[model samples]
Every structure is written in structure tokens, then in C-alpha cells.
Target chain A: GESVGLHLPTLSVQEGDNSIINCAYSNSASDYFIWYKQESGKGPQFIIDIRSNMDKRQGQRVTVLLNKTVKHLSLQIAATQPGDSAVYFCAETRMSGGGADGLTFGKGTHLIIQP
Target chain B: DAMVIQNPRYQVTQFGKPVTLSCSQTLNHNVMYWYQQKSSQAPKLLFHYYDKDFNNEADTPDNFQSRRPNTSFCFLDIRSPGLGDAAMYLCATSRGGLAGPRGFFGPGTRLTVL
Candidate 1:
């Protein structure tokens, strides 16, 4: 069966350095992708999104690159900070016969910033 | 201003007991969504309200039910929670603009079913 990453969660990054988080999708039809940052004891917050028509999208100090050829996605954060420490998740959505299909989420990456 | 608010940040309930999670959004968005996230996992969509129309995920269990009485408030009701029902419940809202509009999410409610 098609699936996403089934691996460890923890990722440690030095402050002021770049951090990259990766995700993979099982569905080939997914057209919209989103990255969310979830701090401890909080819900996931929207960070950035990229459409299927485009290969990459950038925001504030973050960039999301999509490789549709491999069904892979990555989120890059510049100058990692303690405030940026959190769990990051990537989700994908596509239109189906049942209205707008809900998003399918990757497991998650726990980003730890070392000051 | 906080766009979304969820009540009772932490809830503890006994098995087979009914539980209700409440969410309110000030964004006045036309779409509201509910997601269930277990420990160490990603948020899973339970259902959402596009305007007044409700849509439930096909894999969502029958024990979970959602109600969107208006544009601002959405509720998730667990008819009879089991130990496995313990998880974080998140509520999100988005303006019905296009398919990729960013969604605003509220601090989640952590449920513990014993």
C-alpha cells in the first residue's frame, strides 16, 4: 500500500542555521499541499501552502518545495530560532466526488532548536 | 485578536461517558473544520462545515459526531468515548475563497478517556 514516512520524529537543529523537513504522499491526485506548525500543547497552525500547478511557494522566512514527480514535499525554514521549535506536519488535499475531500496528513517532524 | 477559541483546554472523562468539545471563531469564516489528533500523530479530519452543509470523513468512526449550528461555532460530540478516544481536538476556520486558502486553527482541547 502507498504511504508516507514511517520513521522517527525528533530533529535537532542549531540556532541560526537552516532546517529542512520532508514528507511524502501516497495519493497521486492530491493537488493542494499545506505545511502546519504545531507548538507543544497547541493546535497545528498554518505556515505555507503550495498548489499542484506550482512547484514551490515561499513565505516570511520559510519555503515549501514540491516534487510532484516523486510525490515528495519539503519545508525549509531559514535561521532557525527557539520560537520555531515545534512539530511540523504536511497535509495534502484534492477534489473528489464527495465534495472537497479532506486533507491527508503526514505523521510529523519534531523540530528542536538548540540555542 | 485570536481568530479561534476552544474551551476546556484539558478534559478528563470516564469510559462510555459522553463528551462535547466546543470551538468558536471570530474570523466569521464560512468554513469550519474539526480534526482529531492522537499523541505523536498528525491531525486527522473528522468533519467540516462548508457554510451550513456538513461533510464527514468516510473513515471517521460512528462514535464521533459534529454539529455546526452557525457560522461561528462548531461542536464535536463523542457519544461514548473509549480509551482510544483520548486525543487532541482541533478546530479550524477558513474563508471560502479558493481551494488553497490558509486555515486558521485554534488551540486544541486535549481529551483523556479513562
Candidate 2:
């Protein structure tokens, strides 16, 4: 069965420090991966994504690393801020026919930022 | 700015009652999706409408239905609500397949079953 899982359920970091969230996927055929942040009452917000061909992709203050060989993905947040406190989720894109497909999300990791 | 929009941020329905959650996107995306999320859990894909085609996940219950009358609007209908069905429903839109294009999500609607 294809599934995505997180290494940790919760992570705590001080402001200005870096935070890393890890995820492992079972589907070797999955080619695209994404990281999302969800606030207390909001939907998941896109943070960053990485394709299988690319090992790493960087966004503002955030980076996504994908290891296809091990089927592992990680999201690194640099200089963590209080606003970064949220549940982080990793998703694998499943491609079906000729069109885009739905995403399979992993159990989220709660990131807590302390001042 | 163009974005995905969901109406009635909160909803309460009685058990066995029918309810519908609505979503609209101003981005004019070709693909629209509905996801269910419980407490401390990840969003689970329920169904989606690509253009005019409706695709449902295998695990999705027959009690759940969807309608995409046009490109900008999509709806999720629960034929009969259950206590276990209480969860946050999120709507998202994408211009292309999930592999390449970025998807935009709405704030989500919280459903309460009484």
C-alpha cells in the first residue's frame, strides 16, 4: 500500500533557530512531493515542493529536500519565527491518467516556536 | 487576488440530515478538489472535478456526492451526516495536474454533526 508518514509528531524550536520536519513515503513511483503549513483553523498552505528529478528546492526562508532512493523528504525552516508555529504536512502527488492527480498527505508534525 | 473561496466557515447539521459545502475559485483553475481532515490529522482526498469530469476516491463513501457545474464552482454534498463524518472540509484548485502545478486551498469549512 502507498502511504506517507512523519518521523515525529511534534517539534519545538526557539526563535531564530532552524527547524527540520521529516517524512517517509512508501510509494517509489511517486515523483512529486510538497510541504504544507496549516494554522489552527485554516486549510493547508503550500510552503515548498520538490520533483523527483531535483534533490532540493529553496523558497523564502524554507527549503525542501527529496531523497528518492530512500523515499524520504524533509522541510527545513531557517530562522524559525513565532508565525511558523503550525502543523506541517508532507504530500506525495499521485499521477493517474493524462491529467493531474490527487495528493496523499502524511500525518502532520506540529511545530512549536518559542521566543 | 485570485484565490479559492469556501462559504459558511462553520456548519452544524443533525445526524441523517443532508448538507452541502460550497467552494468557488477566482483563479479559473481547471481542477478542483475536496478533502476531509479530522483533528490532528492530514487532509484526505475525497473527490475532485477536472474540467467537467468527476473523479472519486475508492474509499469515499456512497453517502458523499459532488457537483461541478462549471469551471469556477464545486460542491460537496453529504447525503446523510454521521457523527464520524464531523471534520473540516477543504476545497482546493489547480491549473494542472498535482505533479507540476501548485494548488491553492481555501480556508475550509468546519462541520459539526449533532
Candidate achieving the largest DockQ: 2
Residue A27 C-alpha lDDT in model 1: 82
Which number leads on lDDT? 2
A1-102 per-residue lDDT for model 1 (tens digits) = 444552448789999999999998878877788899999898888899998889988999999999999888999999998999999988887644233445
TM-scores of all models? Answer: 0.92, 0.97
The first chain of model 2 has a TM-score of 0.96
Q: Is the docking of candidate 1 incorrect, acceptable, medium or high quality?
A: medium
List, residue by residue over B1-114, the lDDT tens digit for candidate 2.
998999889999999999999999999889999999998889999988889988899999999999999898999999999999999999998877543545689999999999
Top of the candidates by TM-score = 2
Model 2, residue B1: distance off in Å is 0.9
Q: What are the DockQ scores of the candidates, in order?
A: 0.51, 0.62
Fraction of real interface contacts that model 1 preserves? 0.47
